[model samples]
Target: MPASRCGAIRRADASENIWCMTEPSAWRRARAFSRGPESTGHRLTRRRRARMRRLAWVLLAGAALPLHAQNPVEVDAQHYRLEYEDKQVRVLRFRLAPGEKSPQHEHAARITVVVSGSRLRIEDTDGAIYEMTIYSGHAERQPATRHTVENVGSTVYEELTTEFKDAASQPPKLVVKAPPPPPPPPKKEEPKKAEAKKKEEKPKEEKPSVAASAPTTPGAQPAGTKPAATGTTTPTPAQAPAAKVQPEVAAAAPPPEPQPIIKPLKVRPPEEPNRRRRKSFAAEEMSEATVNNTRLAFMEQGKGQTVVFVHGAMGDYRTWQLQIPEFAKRFRVVAYSRRYHYPNPSTGKEEDYTYEANVRDLAEFLKALNAGPVHLVGHGYGAAVATLLAERHPEMVRSLVVSEPGFDKLLDEKRAYRSHWARDEIYNIIRKPLSRQNPENGVRVYHNWLAETQPWQQIDPQEQYERMQNANALRAQTVDPTAPAFNCEAAKKIKTPTLVVAGQNRSPNSAEITGTLAACLANSERVTISEAGPAAYLDNAKEYNDAVLSFLGKH
Candidate 1:
């Protein structure tokens, strides 16, 4: 709690308060009215009243002095735990009542002021003493001390303590008086040593019945022995909490192979019109074959070799919003939103969202439209889809440029991988529902994960939060399907030229995985995009676009 003096002035109205002084110095006249010459019947001179008032001011100032002069904290009077000295020292104050023994304890250096009463018995390993009539206002100082206190007083006792150093503030040569050093710690007696001592002390006093008595050493009593009345011997920890006999439980036969426990797949109903309006941006002239039964909205205008840009998960063609104009000038660019996204509705089932299904869909769309051997560029989750497509249909992929595909190489089947997979799997399952249940708490967890991952940190706060929401929502819609459906193994079999670019700010897992993917491919290159994150294409658009253009031209 802040000191009362540090608080702002009260806004309370003072009109009804006759004793209220408008300012700190107004106590003078108020005091004069209360005290005046007993014989003076008429109104006194203003100067005389002022003189009397001045005296009142002096007294009031004295009474208020303590509030401003010293910082005193009233720690609990019962348990001595306290914080004082402006967070410098922790003070603990306790009082032992009559016939009461304080628990064996220790103090780090302290000074005590005796308030009243005595017959205080302070005990140590050496001996104990009873001090009589320890007067009030007496201060006792102890340094590096350990002892137990007992109060023999009939009435309540009190004490005030102020702690200070055990040594004086001067050089050893100039120092005069200092408390004697505390006694050394007692040597420890090992259990073996104690057992040897016991054997020596009771050489021939042994008896066969001693085993029965042995269990009950000093205070322990066996059956038929009188029960102790005071300070009962607590049974040895092993003897206490006696184990009770429990009825035998027969082991049940193993469950009958769980009956295969196949869960019926829950078919998702067709999405609403609003949900189906998928949007895609294309920067090339579209052929008639491209306008098929698919709910794909595309805008195209450009020239040169066809370059189709695939956006990632929970993303529309808008991801290439910045690249369309630049790439259209050189390459025939086409950006298309995936099914089930805005402006276009998907006719296919939930399987369409799977990596294979997505890649297949893009391949079919490209083939139908006669978009052959087109250079492909994708970002983040989209990069994963692009990799699968390139792997599966190597002939169709002229060259591939994927930026920051989130694949973990270290996350193979192992303790570390299993733990991460479990966490991510649980996160995938519960994130959406949990976030919807409590947004603030959900965002907190998201940001905590974000703080650990560089890609997340590179994103703006608003974007990061939105990404979390979108990811959670996407997870909600597409329940747990499968783990890593992308054919990384097929990547090695791919004969198409490949370019894998990763952001430096992101965890190296992406680049490392990409490196592995590139090594698997017949012709592949691994590159790093500096000052970029997971969405490197967007974070550093021009640099990334140029890199892609250059890679494709060379390939």
Candidate 2:
């Protein structure tokens, strides 16, 4: 789409081409007669004619430009959902129904992560037709190309396209505007009256027709008829054929119940070995243990009293990848992905995830491991899960370490806020996206806010794209209206020794929340890890691990 690659070069090529046509007779005679050595029209050198033909071909190549002005994601919503976007990268989820064909579209150089199997028939601009079979998790690098697509497989075709936006830059003029025009606002409706009526009726509107105890998507109007979560597919207006034969959406099963606490058990805390640094902490293999009806995947190391690590939202057991190996050298360490996380097969079913559901899953897993008086370490949303479990089943937990726990209750008990609070300003960045029906952007906006970074950070595309995959997990949590709040009084009821790990970059309000939590827990202590944000484990593992190890060594 670069202008120099197209328009400017095309104009120059056209002008030179016209001159070439007009001067062909004169040029032919001159080439055959070289001033004094050669006679006119007697002979010509082959090399010059070949060079001219090559020049014409080069000019033709320069004239090629994008056929239309549209981005692939904006071009096809049902088939392509924006998984992530930052200054450096853009990740999109690509899906297609069997026999469906997409209109010709162009993509920059990208890497595709195939999550499901599909056979595709491609019709390239050069008129070549090719068929391909893709397996799950298959990664293929793609060059910039324009093409139409057809799903030849009987099964659905899905893959993740992670475009490295930094590979090249096009001039502003060459950047195509979207095809769809933005809708204008209605002039007839009185904004104030409509808003006033809605405010009065909102409470009644949010009530649900179906009664269910399962955690609802963050979008669920737990309070009243706000509306179901935004990401759930209804019908998109894009002209592309609607995909049929999607994975069946299953009704959420009831949350697992915590089994009766068998025997009270106590396990001694750690003295970790001072091991050398590892080459890489990326998991090469995983071990699995079944608890409840589901199989839980985990990693195990060391051999002492048990320490189970739980991850926050948009994370799996892998979130603690760096810390687990270090801790395993001293204490028996177990880190497992939560339900619906990587390594575990996707249910393909949608449900609102909640602390209660997570707690039930973890409790059963711990019981299955036969490790009680377990040292519990949780981060962010995982921290909330840990706290809830500790409060409900104190006997199963020995000590608790929660990092930057998120409970709406923290937002509610704000002595810092005057008559007006600015948190909503932060909240609305995400709200605006979700309200405008851009759920993926809403997820990224919230993550950017939490990390205390600009709306988009410049990082490796694969790294960001891998994390963007987690954005799908945040959908339910992002809009869950029925999410539980952090209860200070309930936290006070917890007698298990607790450590609250507060990161340095937290907002004053967040700092207060952690501080208040420490104050409430009768036997709790707070420690701050510098140069870290919501996830210290990821930002600076050694500092985070050392703090955690030091605290555990005492208890």
Candidate 3:
């Protein structure tokens, strides 16, 4: 038989053996041979047919499998185990023994927390190789990748990885190009052209029939009538009568006046009722004031009497975000991020990161604002600053609100000694982590201690992120020896209508310090906010705010 009669057969260039039969004749012949008798030739044909059918099914099954099934866990089950999975994220526990190598696998963008130290070699599909030494308890974020990992160290390499599914996981290859210009507007037709179009569209009139000219009786056929056919053919354009041409008087009409372009007005969306949009505290929203050649960032709102808020260590103007709107409703509120805090350039010198320097800055800041005798509020380290400022520059302060001031120097000899010993112990605990270049762990320990909480992991993630922004400042403060000492004498001099606020559940040290300061002040009253910790304002903002507002209203 010729090739056309038999149809064509082609071999596919695939890993799997695939035969393509182009016509129904080839399929019919194969099916017939398979169903034929068990002779030598028949058996051979039947066996070949069965093999092709099996191959076809195998190909379809492979195609049906999901692409994501080729992830690390499924590719190398021995090295990777699925720990947790949800729509937003997938967590996996991975472990590779000494001298062990894993098959090439893919991973989404993930954060890996190392559980054991190891030296490893990684090879990517693109032929690039990387060697790294990772430490136990170290964590880092990695872009989505496909690679083979081999542990070359003497111990097992183990890590817990959380892969993000919500965000773009793959590493980006950026290209810069100018945007394409917009398309031009459509052309409008002129009045003369529009008039000529109308004239061409006029319908033609038909000639009168001969039967109609010779009037016929009712229901009677005319002399020239013919029987009705299935259909009638109209005259072609060449056979049709010529159309009449109109005079040029219509085209002589003047064009109408140009119409004005009407533009749409933009209307703003209505804001949600009873909901105040919180400030983002972005760079643009911040106002800068230079005090003694040092630029400080602050946020101000409202009017009337001024109330200045100074944040402590590990915080910025954003710390008072909860209080700013509430206070601004009644008084002029100004909250500033102290020196060496987040979003501000720092000298990184330990000596400059002291409470005394902060006090000097506050004094100058008040003078620059010229908001005479303003209400002052401070927390933690900032509380000490406010106290020192009031004592030194009495004219600058109207009323003072100090919430659990960390001024150990105001304590008597025995209490001061105990405070120093506790401080040394804390430094000892954080020293190793800082030396290991993991400041987060150090900050965690310090934060837990100050918050009087056992575990730092329970803290809000947003708060943690904001606090980490000032990790450098925390490090500087940790090592600084020039921290200001505010004694009883200094506290006695600050008779600026002081309101010392303390948390009901505050640590013993904080209670003692706050009590001592309150006793030292000649004209001062003390109040405690219940269900709070060292940071009374943050822990119980409503009660703290009400207490402070009541005190401010009195003065």
Candidate 4:
């Protein structure tokens, strides 16, 4: 009970005791004196104060009462039944008797009925008013309303409310304020003349290149390899001799047909350096260095050229389950979950998982397993990771196959739709429960996160749970909104033969961003995988596998 009301009740109790203790005849005899009416006035004042206290007590008691009380007059009876504890609604009934009124309150949603006996008038807090003469069996939808119900009749009134009390219990909610749609992607501008000036300032023939010194063909020798001696005479084969004296031979030799010069075919060497190999999975070999802190759990299979698969956010090596068996037939395939993914305990530190850190981890992992100069294949965020890896460790990557990196650039390009998606997607899913102020709702946020991404749709419920655990660990490492425009310059410096694939009809922004990245690269091209999405690998394993294999080739 409210403290003020409790105090009032105590005062009323004391007053009642005092009245009870006084002998009734004595009290009545004292009340008979009107001369010097001061005592009589004091007695009247005391009675008024006691009555006021009793009224306050009743109001407070009603407010404090549990909603489950059988008394319909209890302030929250219907609200508590609908909002908290679940109850099924069969038929809702409301009854009002003569000369009674309802306390003022707001109704949030439409309900099925308002019935009244005798004449009644409802005045809303907003000054809107309605009058109704209710009878025994009448039923109708209540207005989206806020009001006080009053009885115009001569007797006390009663009210009954019926509603659908049992809504399926929903998980606690979160309120993810949809991020403002990113600004429209900047329009592409043609390279300026100043760009050429910058280009000219730098010396040409930069970096180590075998092609600069070595002969173009395997059998051709470098310029310095053949010594040029002064006045050296070389013997010529005896003149093909007069063998042409015959008429047909004479015609053939008429003018030694001018020899056609054949230029050597120049082939560029692999962009990355070769590294040592580890035992294959079919042989049941395990690397000494673990992917996380645990023993290696990845399967390394087949043996020709090497292809390392990196899974995306909320994914594990199993995401490559279908691709592994197929790709492994023609190439060494190795897939592993990074730390905090699966079979790995999350370190839960943002420092442990920057974009740079992820790339570095892949580098170390490759080194530990004696696998490098690898053809790296990545999906979604994994593509971003792979691109960074190739940029930083160019010597370790032979070629790269990246698909739908899920860069924020996509949302930035399609700002309008992204904004709507964020609101509709996150409001109903993440923000509502959060507005209710419950921390148990964090899990709902994670689930909503998975729902936002396309890949999660293909995963099973058990897999979803496991993936959520990792996402939770990494959630702290959100992209810095103002971080410098993506490090495309860094990525462009990579010379690996890179194939960028985007899924058509998935995320238009994804495709656009993929095109932008490919355009920015020194040796990259983009392709759209028809009818595919973020997890196209799983959606059409054969097609995806074939594309990767074709791009990588035997080398």
Candidate 5:
């Protein structure tokens, strides 16, 4: 409720009895004029005043009514369900059963994470109708608006929508204006003629006494009085010049009465039940922090040579869940979601999601951790990031281990994936789906694209969750404007010992890519593990860990 409205209500309630007490009762009506009958004009005048009082109350009540009366979830519980809410954001799980429709409801500015995609028609607040397809694991930022949804598709439309509630980032609401203060006291007239006459006579009468009170000696007056030469005391009316005496009179006058200090009664906003729970949930999950002013979600454990885990495409910090535990037993491990992945909010603009942005985030992430010269372990797209980090900032890396690295910069397009079936299959799996904003399908393609890799079930549940969380990141990974270039010659110059691991069950195409990369690095060694496919770390954990541990031991 607005402050103005609340006060209006309070004022109305306080004055409700005042009208009855101050106004005459109808029972106190006077006798009819001429003791015959009351004039119709007089009766009408009384009735009009009574009607006006009732109308004032009606107007006051209408003003106190809320601006927004409909609570979206409460009004349309079937379609809109509160997930988690807080002062900062409100998380809602919105869905419609197949063929189901929803009534109009309002939503604030929000970010929507689609769990299931479908074709749907919606009527916006302005009464415009539009049809759009929502894809699973796809994310979008929406401004505040009202709308109704109909699940035109056979399947349900599921979304995890988070709305900001704090004026949606707008300025704070204006406080209500208070009632006017009472009128100030009236001014008083100056002194009368009698007082004025006395003021003139005082100068003449006091001059002699003032002089008599002073010492006869030229140098000093009485001990109780200040000497003329000292000038510390205010001069008397009789001895001082007329102009000086005027200043004395002004100074001697008493101060005016102070106006009472009126401080507004501070009204503390009531705690929202939903928001209270939301904050509790946030406390349990990953605590949010920032890097380069960009918010990041991460977890850290252990206390040795920092082993920073960088994830690949369609992946996040959770991808390293298995590695972190095992490695943290012997070394410090840091796992973090790259920008726009999982809990890490998106920068939103498509142009912001680029390889350069990823690298810059990675650099700042490491700097924020402040664990100097870390041992780098990265998988898939993460492996590519590790490669870039090592190349550009070699001093920050003590040793490097990259699994199934995705550096196509070293590829001779015609002889490599370009003319080959690998490129075509890869495109069919990821690219085509991304064209339609369907990263869910792309995620399946990525995990199962290489048959030689471990079975999908072999991946840890937490890693799977991370992958699903960042399914939307797949498109951005494919569309990065600043794709990295692999330099075989530069790799040869690196003094940092590097271990490149590949899946023993990987296809010939996978082997060729890794083999070429390892050959480029003079101090690097290539290891092929038979335990898993392209993703040796997850598909073949035991062998992969041994390989990494052994290599880390040497370097």
Candidate 6:
């Protein structure tokens, strides 16, 4: 073959073609090259074959390139730091100096919170470039993307980002709007004239009253009945209507006017047995109390001794949907949303989102109610607040019922460490999702981790919506650094009648904390609700209510 043709084929097939050309005999190569005058046809075929092989190799190499690159933290270590990570989410802190550009990287769906304002230029994989102006404290949710970032402004750009690891856990875009009013009930139709006349003519027969027909004395038989050998009396046929009335008088009376027949209204089928309906209180039924300069929304029912329900993080007065109705039958029931919870305006201050603040609010709330010392029932974080209140102002509390109080500080050194570790684990799992402004996913992660069963899926949609409304409070509590410590010494001081309730299937950390509290309280009794976890009241409402009510009755 000619030098140019041999060189092109060698480059295309590499060593194999070169070895074949060099090893072949000189005569054989000459014969193959001299197929025709200048071997034009042979040369053209070889060139086409070589080009096809080269194209195939190029395509294969292109296929080897990755569609998505490594994580941003791995690709740009100088600008990104892995702050936290778990199966559900990964949190990273990023900072870029002025005019600094980062290599292309990949990120999952994430929520970015701007720590410092700056102008940024983003270049996507498809070569699309966009400039964005961001401000400090601004947060926005982003979908999974591959891009390169550059700080185009004069100042450095900094942000904290939470990337969702599970696509299903991504927060949904929520739109707020008033729900449409329910449809009007179907109207009833009037009975036809013929049907009304038939019903009117079918007169109801008159029968003697039992009191008039029965014998007045015991063991006495009626005039038409005869006693049997077995001491059972057999009655003859009922007496015939008296024939004293004249036929002419009866025929003269006009037939009673046709009366309409009323049919029973149709009712919708009952919902699933496990599904709970949303409980709504009328405007007149709900009342508000300003406590500690915060307007607390509350609902009250029944009349007697006052029993106030304090809800935990991510809950409002509606958390006691089950308890309120059951308790209201007897003692007066009051369930109020704490400060920053749903239906209440949030000051957005970190200091107002602690247990101490909650306890102070509860004390002031009780004073405002002026219902005397009231029975206090609290759950989760609220349970801790209830205990603190009892310790600080025993005079304001009649009795205390705390279910699964999350006072990890009260446990022994070993148990406290384990509790803290578990808490951090859970926080890591939910922090990213919560930061993404997706309360529903946060709620799902937290509850799914706390219990073996899927509590989030089992709850009513209205209840889920209610929890999402208080998600900000939960987020604040999770990151609060000034959480008040509750040692056993404080628990020992609470001498009020107390019931420490826990779930039989509660997490080990929760069980330890609650058990420690129970051990420290001098006048406290502990009860466990079966088939329940951290949210015993929701898991087994009847059992939880009975236990709480039984405890309240004594105090």
Model 4 stretches astray by more than 4 angstroms: 1-297, 347-351, 409-459, 469-472, 476-487
Candidate 5: regions farther than 4 A off: 1-289, 347-349, 417-439, 450-466
| lDDT of candidate 6 over 133-238, digit per residue (tens) | 6766799899877777987653456799998866443333333344345679633223323434554576553422222222222112122222222322222222
Q: Give one digit per residue, the lDDT tens place, for model 3 in 466-495.
A: 555566567667675344678788888877
Cα error of candidate 1 at position 217, Å: 78
**Model 2, runs deviating above 4 Å:** 1-279, 290-295, 347-349, 411-443, 452-456, 479-481
- Model 5 alpha-carbon miss at residue 247, Å: 54
RMSD of 1: 33.5
lDDT of each: 0.49, 0.60, 0.65, 0.50, 0.59, 0.66
lDDT of 5 by residue, 254-292 (tens): 343232111111111112232311122121123333555
How does model 1 fare in lDDT? 0.49
For candidate 3, give the lDDT of residue 180: 41
lDDT (10s digit) by residue, model 4, range 1-555: 123433433454443222332346554445436335775677568778879988999988775432322333356343223322233443333443333456654442234433223446887555566886554235555533445677553222233444433222111222323334556864321232343455457565422222332222111112111111222211111232453233432332223223221111111211221211111222232222243322223447789878889987656566676787778888888886664454333333333555665666777777766665889999866788888788778899999998866555434444434433432433344333323323224333433333323433343433433344444233433422111135456657889999987665444345557766888789886666666655677656667778777888845
TM-score of each: 0.43, 0.47, 0.49, 0.43, 0.45, 0.50
In candidate 2, which residue pairs get closer than 3 Å at backbone N, Cα or C atoms, i.e. clash?
205-225, 206-224, 206-225, 207-224, 207-225, 217-480, 218-479, 218-480, 219-479, 219-480
TM-score of 5: 0.45
Best by TM-score: 6
Q: Which pairs of residues clash in candidate 5, taking residues 3 or more apart in a chain or in different chains?
A: 312-381, 312-382, 452-533, 453-533
Model 3 lDDT vs. the true structure?
A: 0.65
TM-score of 4: 0.43
